[model samples]
Target: MSRTSGATTSPGAALAALAGAQFTVMLATSIVNVALPQIRAGVGLSDSGTTWVVNAYGLAFGALLLAGGRAADLLGRRTVLLAGLALFGVSSVAAGLASSSGILITARAVQGLGAAAIAPAALALVMDLFPPGPGRGRALGVWGAVSGAGGAAGVLLGGVLTQALSWPWIFYAVATGAFLVLAAAAAFVTTTPVRESGRFDVLGTATVTLALTALVWGLTTARRSGWTDPQVLGAFAAAAGMTAAFVLIERRHPNPLLPPRLFAAGRVTAGNVLMALLGSVWIALFFFLPLHQQQVLGSSPLLTGLGQLPLAAANMLGSTLAPRISRRIGATATVTGALLTEAAGLLWLSQISAHGSYLADILGPSILIGLGLSTAFVQLTALSVEGVARQDSGLAGGLVNTTRQVGGAIGLAVLATLAGTVTAHAATHQPHLEALTAGYRAAFGISAAVLAATALLAAALTRRGSTPTAGEPVPAGPASTAARAN
Candidate 1:
């Protein structure tokens, strides 16, 4: 049998495993939010210590993503996937069993390291399973749906597990899921050929990793301590210095961590840029929307999680329709429309009041936001990898994910700081609830404006997009004849 035939024979099983791997990685990010209170009480953690629990995962995940992606290209995708899953599962077990703050934080950081390896490798495998075109588009649509829903599901699952069982159960559940995916991946996923290129650029890798680590650390810290805080400024300075060093290293190194040629492809650059903007709104939405539901509306954690169901459903629908829409209207138009839709939702969401009902204040906007964000995510993700060489597929995956992650971190910090300032000023004259609502309103309104502006920029950037129509397939190289299992 042909290599393509061998890869395509069980596309369903492969997609399922890949999707499961990615889902678990995303789930770990937000699953801890609802359970934070329980975790704090259980471990007797201080506020600062508790904050580190989340930051640790994000820091490690963001920092190591490029390295992981490069490793997958140099090593084998299947090998990296299995190793990542093992580490993630073991770390999760350690997190669940931990009784001290230090142990839990360390475990979460280790879990993130594993996730960094899993995310890029899994995405690259998806690109490998289905070659570029409608088959790839539809496959990525499923990938998009799960990716969007993962955050929503994490919130719901965290509430359920924490309320019914305990916080540690959340960690245990992820561990179990990771092991299952690991097994399925081993059985179904095919190994792709690794490029026999120049040796790894160890200096390039170290510099970039440190840069991202410092940047993420600064952003996360800025949210807690004001942006002008000395330590936060120091971290930012360190990130800038490290990033500069990385660029210099990549320029001189024989084997660069990120090839400069990758950015020569317009879609790769534009896609990453747009994804960052979308990610800003995406992360902030989850943060503020939940706060509004719980703090302003006085909904229980369970109810807040339940309220996200509509948004999740709408997101899935949008993702399902993304390929068809892109085929009909083209990628640029589809992305522009999606961004406008999300902006409208955010504008509406900004009108949220202290005396608001879920149906009246939240549900309508949530639907629009879900549909818009998910579709945009699908299209932009496709655009990022379009025309990328097979050898650079893993790097593309890592770059896109890194942009989203970094963008989210930056967005959350800025928006949260702005909201806090608004709340503080309003509290002097307004009722506490009203003051809180005002701050949320400011955040949503600003986000809407940002998205609207980004829509214009996206249109301009992707004006020359050569994205194929739905029925047209790109010239096949590897893994082109995969069955349309979806």
Candidate 2:
């Protein structure tokens, strides 16, 4: 079976449409961070309840990814893409208008559901546009860079909107952007023919979706409740049981939502592991550094976001050079090297003083971490989806994203627990600012260690001299052809 045929439309315009969708959805994820204070004050939400505003989105978005990915294959990319965006737009409207915390959190969850559909479909379209080659690499670089920039840019944009207008404007702006993306998509994205038939794996979808939801819910809930809380433990246990059952069901089901073989592939597995680790670091940087700037350095939210601007620029630069670096030394070495660089940067950030400034403490680390993270985003994206069957394009896309999101959620939870405990202990012996800085430093150091371990594992798993590719040879197996199974 052939992968996506080349786009009949202008590829550049098509890239813009797809990349724009990516940017918009990702922007939604981080935009709320800067506006959290306003949201809490305006909506009369308590500190703890407001946390759900973001967690609700992350949980739902991460949970539905597998179903969303496979739906694009069974239904159609264009259909799923538009439908997702419409849902996202409507939810954004609801959120902007919401007065109660419950209403806003509910809307964010729905928005996340829309994002789940948009992300995989948008990525699949980009792959369909540029087949495996230098062209695909270049396109993915643009795509990854834009997506990364959105995560950073969202804070700046959110701060501006929240300060100038109100917190609601953040939702309003994204909703408007969603409409524009829809317009561009309608014009540039070609309709995809549904390539499969029969029942979408209902059992598999239910089990996996529930598993992921439970996992994310548990992780997010752990921050408020201690990690040892019975509720948290139960949620995690249920997630594990459900995941195991899903695997068992997939093994026997005629048309599984996730093909076992896809997960079994060497490149796919290795890339996903690396993606998860890098995701942890990426998230740590985004979450902790901003807090450091605001709390430790006493900067405004707008300044905190603007300080990250350099990191975004460095990300673009790294993305541009990733393909070249991979070609010269192979994807394995390049990714491994990038991980080491990321770890080094995190190590540098761990040295921040209680009275540190952005330039002295944040700038250099931001650039180093951004370059390393962006390069890995490019290479790992290429690797995870490498040689995937045309039929599983959306599934492959979703898998990569799912790992990143899940990893970020889990890693953030674990790190938060560690930091809080450390800070509490240090508070007894040190000043409040120094104690807080100590917690952050410990988190950075631990994150660096985690990245280093992933780097070593990546070096072992990735083949020597195997360059990252837009087109690699897919192993034909039950997973690749299960859509046609009886």
Best by TM-score: 2
List TM-scores for all candidates, in order: 0.92, 0.93
Tell me the lDDT of candidate 2.
Answer: 0.81
Q: Report residue 2 deviation for candidate 2 (angstroms).
A: 14
lDDT, each prediction: 0.82, 0.81
What is the lDDT, from 0 to 100, of the residue 329 in candidate 1? 86
lDDT, candidate 1, 80-170, per-residue tens: 8789999999999999999999999999999989998898888888888887667888898999898888877877887788878899999
Q: Which ranges of candidate 2 are over 4 A from the true structure?
A: 1-7, 192-194, 264-266, 464-486
- C-alpha displacement of 183 in model 2, angstroms? 0.6
Distance (Å) between predicted and true CA of 383, model 1?
A: 0.6
Worst 10 residues of 1 by lDDT: 477-486
